[model samples]
Target: MEPIIHGILLAFGLILPLGVQNIFVFTQGVTQSNFIKALPAAITAAICDTLLIVLAILGLSLIVLQFDWLRIILVVAGILFLVYMGKVIWTSPAANNKETVALSMKKQILFALSVSLLNPHALLDTIGVIGTSAVKYSRQDQLLFTYACIVVSWFWFFGLATFGAVLKKVTIPQGVFLLFNKSSAVFIWGTAIYLLIGLWQGAY
Candidate 1:
């Protein structure tokens, strides 16, 4: 019971931070014509998290992520990708957005996977936090903890998507979505710059 509760709390703590993955899910929710249309993003993000959590707990990180150079590579790749995405978002014309339809499931899944899998912080959280925490538990307790964590990921995504959907009542969704894209661009660029500075300072 304690382990279950601990897992939930840990997951919440790790995921509550504003990051690329969370923002992706939230933006999908806001831009999608309906909450149902946002499911692909939520599901894909959750699936990526599930894979990370399982592999982290199974000690794959110890085997494959032992090299500092590998971590650096991931950091560099993530930064480059984020910077490009930020520019795309910031430069997208708002006038064309009103006619935009909900994202196809394929695009949603791909985008979700990109943000969820590529984020260096998410990888660290999986290995450093979830993996470490699971090591202290018995096999049965580990299963319970893992399940709780997975559930939290799914719930959080849906909750975020729901919040986005709710905004439809307050104003024009296309305008709100365009505004969100700009905000998301700022966030992505800020994160990229922070990562670059951190790497320069050997903060990683």
Candidate 2:
């Protein structure tokens, strides 16, 4: 019981921080008005995270942890990916339109996967935090820990999506939309830089 409590607390602690995922979800809520669209993105991210968790349990992530060069490579790639996303978001038009809606599903899924899989931060969370923490528990406890992590993912995704969809109906100026996009760009790029710094520090 105490393990479960700790697992839940850890999940909340890890996710409550500001990151690309949170920013994207908030922006989606502001623009799409339908939080359901964010569901796919959230689920995709959760699935990727679950996979990492499982891998960590199997000791695969230990291999990753041991390889400094691999971490460096992933961090660099993640930074590049975030930069590209930031550029696209910065250039994107603010108005809600059919074209945007049509592309939303694809874009959301892709972004979720990219953020989950490519981001060094996600790797750190899974490998460093969750994985290391799970070692103290028995196999059953580890399973429970993994489940708690999934619950965290599900709760955050659903909650954010629902919140965002609700906000979609609120009247806002066009400039606000533009500002949101630009702000998201800043967030994405900033996170990427932070990940790069972590990688550099680890490498050296």
Candidate 3:
């Protein structure tokens, strides 16, 4: 129970922040034709998180993060991906949810993968925070902790997407959603810039 509670709290704290990954998932839900159509993003993101959590607990990710050059490569790739994603979102037609061409399943999965695996911050958080925290637990407790985190991640993303889908049903003006897209793009770009700064400062 201690492990479960700790895992839930930690996972929620990490995920509650408004990040590029969350934005993309929510945007997909709002812009897609229906809730079901948007699920690829949520599902893919959940799977990615699950993989990361498992690897982190096993200390596999720690090895990758140990090399300075490898970390640099990851940050560089993440910056480029975030920049490109921001542009894509900024240009998407957000004026009408029904009229907009939602991202295909392929694109959704690809983007979800990029945002999940490419983002250095997320990787570091998983490996640094969760990985270190797991060290204090016994083997059985570690398994419980991992399960708790994975479950929270899956539920949070699905719930977030569902919330966005519900918002689509409201009578909000199209301009509002368009504004949201623009804002989301800008936020994503800001995150890219932040990562670039961190890289420059050797914060990665």
Candidate 4:
């Protein structure tokens, strides 16, 4: 019981941080009024996250745990990917062009799945944190933890998408919106740097 509670808390802790998914959702919300479009993105991400969490629990995480060097490589690659994505978000047009860039449902779904599945940090979150945390529990407890992770993924993506949708109501200046975008970029870059530093330290 205690482990289940702890697992839930830890899952929340892991998922609540600002990351690529959150940034994408928030930007989409601010730039577009189509909340329905955002649903596919969030749902796609949730599916990917759930799949990865299941894979982690089923022993695929061992591949990550066994290869020390792979962590460093993944960390480096993740940082680069974050940095690149941040730049793209920073340069994205404002609400004026929202109609033009508002993706089709199929494209949005594919983009979300590609981004979530390809992200090294997502793998780390599932395999490194969730998988390892579930190892000490019985099979039932492990299942509970896995389900908890799925819940966390669903909650975060849905909550963030909703928040982004609400931001569309604000009558802020375009410049302010651009400033928010830049700030999000900075946040992503900062996280990338932190990850890189951790990888460097661990390598020594």
| Predictions: Cα RMSD each | 8.9, 8.9, 9.0, 7.6
Q: Candidate 2 lDDT, tens digit per residue, 16-92?
A: 54367665665566566466656777677667877887776558344445665664554565567667766876787
Q: What TM-score do all the candidates reach, one by one?
A: 0.63, 0.61, 0.64, 0.62
By lDDT, rank the candidates, best first: 3, 1, 4, 2
Per-residue lDDT of candidate 3, residues 1-204 (tens digit): 988986876676556554678778877888888899999999999999999999987873355446657656656765676677568667866544342347999999999999999998689657755664555456788899899989999998998789778886455566765676677577656656766776778665
lDDT, candidate 1, 34-129, per-residue tens: 899989998899989999999998773454346667656656765776677668767765422222346889999998888998888789778765
Which pairs in model 2 have colliding backbones?
29-164
Looking at model 4, residue 184 earns an lDDT score of 56
Error of model 1, residue 23, in angstroms: 0.9
CA error at residue 136 for candidate 1, angstroms: 0.5
Q: Could you tell me the TM-score of candidate 2?
A: 0.61
After superposition on all CA atoms, how large is the RMSD of candidate 1? 8.9
Error of 4 at 114 (Å): 1.9
- By lDDT, the better pick of 2 and 4 is 4
Ranking by TM-score: 3, 1, 4, 2
The per-model lDDT (C-alpha) reads 0.73, 0.64, 0.75, 0.65
For lDDT, the strongest prediction is: 3
Clash count, candidate 3? 0
Model 1, stretches more than 4 Å misplaced? 60-102, 169-204
In angstroms, give how far residue 151 of model 4 lies from its true place.
Answer: 0.6
